[model samples]
Target: MITRRLWLSAAAAVATTLIPGPAIAAEPLEVTAPTRVLGAIVAAEGGAAVVVRIDATLGPADLRVAGAVHSVAVSQRGLLDDPRNAPRVGAGVRKILSAVRPDLAATFEANHKAWTLTFVRKVLAWNARLAASPVRGKRIVDSFDRAALLAWAGAVVDPKGQPSPPALARAPKDAAASTLESYVAYVEALVRSLE
Candidate 1:
């Protein structure tokens, strides 16, 4: 079993080589909203628990960190355009009906499934990439980069199309850092809980 500290250390080591950033030590991972949600979902024994955790943490996202979670989740379901991505029975889909937003049960279920799928895919991809690219100091890029970039993009633009000057000036940089940091934390928590 991979411990969180060891896993993060390995990841930071790899990232230091591939990513063009200062040689600063990896920041201590923060247990942000997304980290909590993913950890709860992985630790949950039943769909009801999953529904409760997701609702409590992800239901009303007021902060940029939590909102980035919503964005990452929506992207996982292909932005909810196609109905094919939604799970018909699992991922707390049925449990969410009574827990929250009964009218939008399907949407909630789709989001739940999307996040779950993304969790599984990221873990699997992490393992695969780790195994395939075992050589030290090798530069490798993957979906984690895409997710962080997308999170940055989502952070900058206001969906209402009227971003304030202050927001426009600061959101991208802050969101990019927060998104990447929170994403790594979330992934590490998931691996620790699920593995």
Candidate 2:
């Protein structure tokens, strides 16, 4: 009986190894290494400009699709003119973004609302982190910066005041895209401040 049992177990193992089952599951978008790394790069370094510049290069349809991915922010007053460094910064961000693009598409395709909120939370976390850190001129954010971030997040979720503008109102069909555009504008202004 033991011998029979051993033979059966071995046969089962062999069968399992030979038979094709299902594809391996993918990691969640928010927790994936590429997403986290991209977030860190954007938060730690002044990488939002790279995002904005990339957005500018996209055609209208592509830009709308990308809105479903993530938005970049900077503050105009805080922007510094460093044309010399733009190429280097764009290259690094492009490399990381290429890695992230597939996951972003899959996540948005799977659920657009979840994708929007995921990025909203990401920006909020960035805001909170910056707010908590000690301000060093444009290098870090403070309590004063939290309001805009909070308002942006709130507007995306509920669109009623909280610094609401008509453009960000949930328009049923185009809600996700519009929210993304609003997020991009907010981030662009914030990044300008940081730079």
lDDT of each model, Cα atoms only?
0.34, 0.34
Runs of candidate 1 with Cα error greater than 4 angstroms are: 1-90, 93-98, 129-184, 188-195
- Per-residue accuracy of model 1 over 1-195 as CA lDDT, tens digit each: 999999999999999889897655433222223333233332221222222222234432211221233222334411111112223222432343324334445654565655556555654565544343222122223222222322222222224433222312222211112222344454443223212
Instruction: For model 1, state the Cα shift of residue 97 in Å.
Output: 5.7
Model 2, runs deviating above 4 Å: 25-55, 63-110, 113-195
lDDT (10s digit) by residue, model 2, range 77-177: 11211111223332343334445655343332333333434555655565554454222222212223233333322212233323322222321211112
Give per-model TM-scores.
0.25, 0.24
